[model samples]
Target: MVDHLIIFTRYPEPGRTKTRLIPALGPEGAADFQRQLTEHTLRQVRSLQQRRSLRVTWCFSGGDVAAMQGWLGSDWDYQPQAAGDLGDRLIAAMHNAFAAGATTVAFIGIDCPAIDAALLDQAFHVLEAADMVLGPADDGGYYLIGLCRPVPELFQGIDWGTAVVRQQTEAIAQSLQLSSHLLTPLNDIDRPEDLPLWDAVQRQMLSVIIPVLNEAGNIRPLMEALQQVPEIEVIVVDGGSQDGTAAIAQTLGARVLFTNSPRACQMNAGAAAAAGGILLFLHADTRLPHDFPTAVRQTLDGAHVVAGAFDLGIQGARWGLRWVEWGVKWRSHLCQMPYGDQALFLRAETFRSVGGFAELPLLEDMDMVRRLKRVGRVAIAPGRVSTSGRRWEKLGILRTTLLNQLILLAYHLGVSPNRLAAWYRDRNFSK
Candidate 1:
């Protein structure tokens, strides 16, 4: 039989979800707890995978598929939960599963952690003798529902979210002459007292590398922000900053390394010292998306994709800044190219095999992107990375834009990067 498992869940947006638990956990706390439950449930799914070759589907609400993939990684087929009551959504999910060639289907939520791999296997085994299997929750509702075939009528006209939910389902099954089996009842942690039962889950570490030159004013705030992210280690590579940038970064608790090398060389040095399995090359004045960790992981998980970068968002009030953002998006998509300011990230092994960023003062990001494209596809994530607009503000948008295009053209026409670097230093904004 085409065994499929569908998980119903809501994206943990604060104040919008898990409201019943807010009084005890607060808004953000509730959201955090919801995320913890989601992760715990996923680990159990992984354990189930070790025993069965079942298709896993995520019937999600609150966020788009991209955001879901960014949060949970690119493993499950995410389908939007249908509109209406809980019963309506369940009916739709069951219908979708059967339509996709599933001979048997099991549905669940993140509410109960007691539904382990053994419990899931028992549900399928019960399906051999019964048309339906139900795992009753300690609460009035059930933790899980499974069916050997589509039984749409059994889901109709039930009082969802009530103690009678299990009873109603049983009555409906009896009316339809469908054989049913009941598994052991599990608990759904709705009250404050249930918090003690949660198991700890470990997340992967992300190593962020930033190459700086005389950015003392900006380094502290950037490090402070990066410090708030759990399991993230920040590496600041300073190229002999005279403005005490290294001192500020070190004081801010970042792992600081000194290098007399250029931008590409400094980045390479930082990458070599990183302890994480994944490496993200960030610009000194750029801010990554909030869900950066998940986005980076999911994008790299795509088939044939080895590296990825975010779209560019210039920070400015000028109307031309909007056009600049549009241009950056199109360039990144149509060109499959992104600059260092876009915050390029990839697995450590992939980067090491490619010999890291090339040692060049100018067009190094472009050169790296060109070489990377030869090995695998590059994924450009949806959210834009906000970068400092000081360059455009100082040089005027038109002049700054023209200068960048001309420099790129010259580099394409076989001009040496050393020559380009000299030209850049002479005309660089002296702010």
Candidate 2:
């Protein structure tokens, strides 16, 4: 039978609500946005609850639960958010709800603006038989998590914000023999760029390999950063870099391979030479986080898991990066998909297993990820890799976002690599 629907939320305050966004929108602006967004989401959930016998419970925190009583009105139930990380709170609420005679329970957040009535209905409908149902967010987290029979194992031992949240949960479920279902995806905006495609979060990940040319000055720092993580293996394919890139690579101990012109060839050569079970084609300027090795190693250890990447950050110390950092990292967690600049990592076996880097002048990453998904799961982790945002800063945000999306569309529609390469060159995006 369908049970209670829990709306997981925290009090919308200036400092507490989405503090990461504060970097871009400031504290007050972020809080105001949170207030409006939460109100909108509550309205949607309220509308959904009206149709079914499903009980609606407000799991609130960061302030008195009583404060939301007036906002939600007298009919709905309100419960304070327990003190703990996200997982602890969720588990506590679910346990309480079940103990209080709820046979099935569903939990959701207020961040996904596009989540509407129909999706929530489906989640309830599916839970009648399924042990669990999840509405996978484009950012990697689930918008709605519903469970009919309690699977306590599902709630334990996860890197909550990492790409492995869903995968890890699924593993626990399988090990316990629980049945589950998945709903169509929805986007949750945690970044400024997300404001545009907030509606398309359900779509799939498009892997795009970006090759670096004459990046002699940038290569070492990036390689050194990658090496600190033992799980990641560096493969540098130089297109005869005259700036002593090869010599530098050898000096730093990165596996350097020689290749002819074309970033595609370089990437393909690098993939051919990569020794790790997964090949990560990173640009010379990118800097990944410290925990990436553990994340990638854990992913490789999973069954039906293929390839993935981390969230994006910039190379230097820019205060403006705080927003990008939050946006990229949160989006990676919610969507389970990472950007190429995040230094994409995949099973080395899966890389060769799926025929590594396509010889595409542009959008090779997109091409490869599409193939990778078919064999297993791909994810975006909370860990971040810093890339050169100089191109975006110079080209203008609107212009760069537009150009890349257009190229992405063209690539997905099967545009010839050569033609896209021509278009890419015209844009003059610097490495």
Candidate 3:
């Protein structure tokens, strides 16, 4: 005997599920409304199930198991809706729930906005005195239905989409001498006039933008690691990589955008295309540390810091690399500046307001830091992001360190970025 709360919804296809509001919302808006509604309902049920002793399921339509998993997630039980109209499907679902040993089963549609955990609990409590529970809709239909056991007669002989649905069902209950209870009337979002219910509520997402030029070897692991984070959206901005970098990143579920532009320009384009509220500029060969989100959130929550970067951990055994990492930490803390290899992150608004990265091919990171400091302070997260030491391995530690310092010196002394880039290129002439 188990309590099961099921949400019956469509897989959010445009021009199909919520067609009534298309004139006002357009096809894209209607689909977004349905998808958000379904997500909101599932979140509510998932929260309730975490503390209570009940199970949850999504009895969905318009998509198969794989498609549903891609759209939502594979964290809950899912069942395909049976063939026929809405009434037949609802009846079949109820009967199946009872046959599967449910003590009390409640189901609601994606349309209703008033369904909450308390009302669901009330449905279960009312089941002790009543055989069935019905949440009437203001449009004369019903938004929610539940039962302690399968009642075949209550679902039959009633026109489903008609305004007299609730009335006819109540009449049928009276004739069969079955006790029933009516929940509060709800107005489901079914027409163009009801679009204001979803307004001004923001969804916070973090976009992890990685700029790559022929980094096929490092794409997979980086994408997988970022995918583990909850609100992260990984993007691989490729700069004319002949290697299978684009294909590999897409296979690993990271969005890929191509450009022949420099790393700074590619990063800016990726940031422009990102749909997240925050932008985390990562290197293609970098691996982020655990608890990175919490660190970033705490660091950025302060009024002073408008941008932050993770501590640096060079991925190499050479003891000299440890000192290189120390140099980065000191520069970030004392100078309040970090290069892009440190996995810099900032709010999207701040990034845009800073005019984004300059189109310069070199010193773009330092250039952005100077401008960023003018607006607010920068911070460093406790967690570290490990970057590949391939560069250090190619050029010995002393030589590489000297070259970087010389480049920074030249840039500060008013050397043009194009000239610095040409010199930097001459040094990294090999693989």
Q: Please give the CA lDDT of all the candidate structures.
A: 0.84, 0.69, 0.80
If candidate 2 were superposed on the true structure by all CA atoms, what would the RMSD be?
A: 22.0
Model 1 Cα displacement at 415 (Å)? 0.5
Give residue 81's lDDT in candidate 1 (0 to 100).
97
Q: lDDT of candidate 1?
A: 0.84
lDDT of 3: 0.80
- Residue lDDT tens for model 2, 283-371: 77776666665665676556766767776777546565566667667756665556567777775456677777777666666667677
Using TM-score as the yardstick, the better of models 1 and 2 is 1
> Model 2's lDDT to the true fold?
0.69
TM-score of 3: 0.65
If ranked by TM-score, best first, what sequence of candidates would result?
A: 3, 1, 2
Per-model TM-score versus the true fold: 0.54, 0.47, 0.65
**Candidate maximizing lDDT:** 1
TM-score of 1: 0.54
Pairs that clash in candidate 3: none
Q: 228-260, model 1: which lDDT tens digit per residue?
A: 554466788998899999877866656688887
Cα lDDT of model 3 by residue, 1-431, tens digit: 58877789988888887889889878887887787677656545643654457777788888788888766665667899989877788888888887878988888887875576677777777877787899999989998888888777888888988899999998988898888889998888888777554441212456789988888888888776765554356678999989999888876656678886688889998998675667889888888889787787788887889899988999889999999999988999999989889889988889999999999987788888889999999989888898889888998888888888998999889998888888889877322
Ranked by TM-score, the better of candidates 2 and 3 is: 3
